[model samples]
Target chain A: MSVQSKPRVRVPATAAKGELIEIKTLISHEMESGQRKDSAGKAIPRKIINKFTAAFDGKVVFEADWQPAISVNPYQSFFYKAQKSGAFTFKWKDDDGSEYTAESKLTVT
Target chain B: MPNWFGIRTATATRRQALTAGAAGALAVLLPRMVLADEAAVADALKKLYGGKAMAEGRIKLDVPPIAENGLVVPIGVEVESPMTEADYVKAVHVFADGNPLPGVVSYRFTPDCGKAAAATRMRLAQTQNVVCVAEMSNGTLFTAKSNVKVTIGGCGG
Candidate 1:
């Protein structure tokens, strides 16, 4: 199975210069706990997205590390004050070494 | 004969009912209780604000005190910030401290964000602590927390 499904990211279309803007992101995932048992009662090996990062204009804005227990389709919402109009990149990575990325741009008016 | 009678009476009375009730409730709630133990927000909190003292403040967290749906609950946190380059808001981190992974998400920021705020929807395993931590550029951390009561559990409920 693919490690992760596509992620969705959204940011406001316009913001006042120097306004703190909100960013939202979500990933489609099945964060399986290793402790789960299959139909045959065998333990289901853990599969999880272990890390996430948000970068704005090549500078890191937010980053996180997740454990096996995180739920499927993890959602995150956060804020960054707009310094200048640029793109924000969001990345999600799994324990098996796979990565997915999404980006959103903000316009300062 | 006396010992046998006492044992039989005990099994037929209050002790038996209490034992049965506790066991039944536990059996029904055990899976949910364990599943509800995950908190991604709490994990994120420690990672970002490790070794920093967090204090309660006027920072407002806009969220339903009671969430009807456990899967997606809307939440917002706004803190008062000067928004200056020397002492502006640095980063905002939100956590569902009691969920399976306590550390749910982290947002780093700068003075450019005129104010300190964030809003998003997240899956909560159960009723838990939704904590907001704001790190200032001056290396200080401010915090606010609220308890959200969830009727139906969201963690695979």
Candidate 2:
């Protein structure tokens, strides 16, 4: 079964060539660590976004190996230099083999 | 005004003075309290990079000096890197010495990432040092640390 998740990414619409720009990302996830019990005292299987990767123009720019400690609705902010106008892709993988992806475009002047 | 040392010598015994001095020195030397998960950080470090010497600069770890809530503490880490294909940061690992699980998160970056920097929120169990270790593409490691003081609110001490 697939879960509903929304990945959000923020990148500047325009940037000067070679300018470093900040990229902010957030995803809506329950991030169940599998350590907690439900109302019926049943163990909730761990379902967390274990990995995140970002690529610009087919080149991976940033990635992360997440653990169960990551809070719900994982949010991260990083930086990337605008080398050229291209599309930035962000992907998040869950422990249950689910992948959620989002994309944004950058226009380098 | 009376000299500070003269007043301390008048009422305190030699043993008392020595004990006070030792306590003060200990407080300075050992800033962090002993926690059950103390060795977890070391184990994590060993697992990530065994026997590798980690330099103590180039990474800036930003954490609040005091946290109003331990449930959520903001953390930011920035590493000095050229972010070029020839020389860039490979990954960054974050750890909290006092948490039940010392390993917090690890971030990997490529040359396209421009700057080796990241910001996130973490759950800190108590007052402790937040450590960030950045691995360069050339296999060098740089580390930095920041202490956060957590207070249990809503109770009048």
**DockQ-derived CAPRI band for the predicted complex in model 2:** acceptable
Candidate 2 residue-pair clash tally: 0
Give the winner by DockQ. 2
lDDT of 1 by residue, B43-134 (tens): 45556666568777847888799988766677776778776667777666667765655555555555545566665566676778777777
Interface RMSD of each: 3.9, 5.0
True contacts kept of each: 0.37, 0.71
Evaluated at residue B128, the lDDT of candidate 1 is 82
For B1-157, candidate 2 gives per-residue lDDT tens digits of 5798888777678779889999998787444433426578878889889958999999989889999886667788889988888999999999988765676789998887788899877766677888889999999998888888988421111
lDDT of 1 by residue, A8-93 (tens): 88789788876666777888888775645667867777787777888879887666555543456777666777767888888888
User: Which residues of candidate 1, in runs, are more than 4 Å off?
Assistant: A1-4, A12-16, A33-37, A40-43, A64-71, A80-85, A104-109, B1-25, B28-53, B91-97
Q: At residue B59, give the lDDT of candidate 2.
A: 92
Segments in model 2 whose C-alpha atoms lie over 4 Å from true places: A1-3, A38-43, B1-36, B152-157
**What is the DockQ (computed on Cα atoms) for candidate 2?**
0.35
